[model samples]
Target: MSVVAERPVVAEESRAVRWWRRPWVGPLALVVVVFVAVSVPRYLTLDPAQSLVPPVEGFAPYYPMLVAHVLFGSVAIVSCCFQVWPAFRRRYPVAHRWIGRAYVFAGVLPAAVLATVIGAKSPFGPVARVSNVLLGLVWFGCTLAGWRAGRARRFGDHRKWMVRSFVLTISTVTNRVWGVVAGVVLGPQLETTFGGNEQYMTSTIAGLTTWLGWVVPLILAQLWLDRRPKKRARAAGRSGVPA
Candidate 1:
């Protein structure tokens, strides 16, 4: 057996893994995220009664807050899909810049603010309210840091912070996923546990999901980022240049 003959299989395997990680994996996940984000807006507009907002009385503030959160959040989520697409980012850098600007300012900032306010009034109770407040603050902080890094010409720092921000932004979907699972598992026990009060059970579950949803995904992303090589190093390797 020759060394060169044995190496071809290794090289082919490496290429397959790279292709899966790049175009296939990222694009497929992006499609799912974009689909969910786009579908959510319809519930906000077309099916308000059947939407996530609880039908509590004295709907003075909750209604407006829900609307603002949904609209701005939808904008942010949709914009994020384009911003993170590797091909779009590379081909249309200028468009990427503008989309990111709109994402941070018009989408994330307003949505986070509204989320904090709405969370305070959650029918579930103080636990969920506190979770919302924390999530909102962290989301806003990550996005602002990302924007500031870009302004300071620290592209690496900007990219890291933006990745964190986008993870938090996409947590809306994760949160819902958790919520559904919890509802299904805890459905029968809710009445017995919470004195048959749907509101109390709802509040408890919301708080639990809020913490688990975003925190777990952010942790996973951080681990991936820590393991991944720096972009400059990757480019250097590709170009046969020293890093």
Candidate 2:
């Protein structure tokens, strides 16, 4: 077969085996939906001066951290949202690489650093602090791995690492999810209506998000990556090929 004829076949096969088609779409869509749902309120209700947790000073801690949070958060969200879209990956490989780099440098690094530093003094508790730090580190690692994988042309590995990166980045989405749910369900009534308690609601929400947000991605990654060897071994056993 001519190289040109084989190119499309190779690309199609690659995308089919990319592994984001099953079950990954659900959580990624959920995060997007949640992001659109809460973003308007977050912007309209912007008050960067207040502390979601503590270690409050003037603008020293809160503002810088929040700025980093929003900037990096935006990169992470955008990168994650498009990482699995094959059309985008193929049609805009250069753009994808650029965005992916931005996600690592602009998003993952700052988010990890600020999350670690700010988490220590959070009013949410030790569990929340630790979870945030851990999430930050993991997300950073994911981005780094994605970068390395892409550099080495390990495209499948790149896709997997990017999936994990986006999953951790969805911590923001998770935070907002619990914040909204807690307000509607768990919060005390204020004159038979909700009013101006977002920060309070999100206090513990951050920790819950950090810990639980990763559960889906972790399980998916383990199944996707690790299950292959087991499956092959079982087939080998049945065929009596080896071992």
Q: Which candidate is the best by lDDT?
A: 1
| Prediction 1 global C-alpha lDDT | 0.82
> For residues 75-157, what per-residue lDDT tens digits would candidate 2 score against the true structure?
66767666666656767888888877887888787877777777665667677778777777877788799889989999878
For candidate 1, the 10 contiguous residues with the lowest summed lDDT are 12-21
lDDT of each: 0.82, 0.68
Candidate 2 lands at a TM-score of 0.68
lDDT of 2: 0.68
Winning model by TM-score: 1
lDDT of 1 by residue, 17-63 (tens): 55345665476467656766666665666445756667447657687
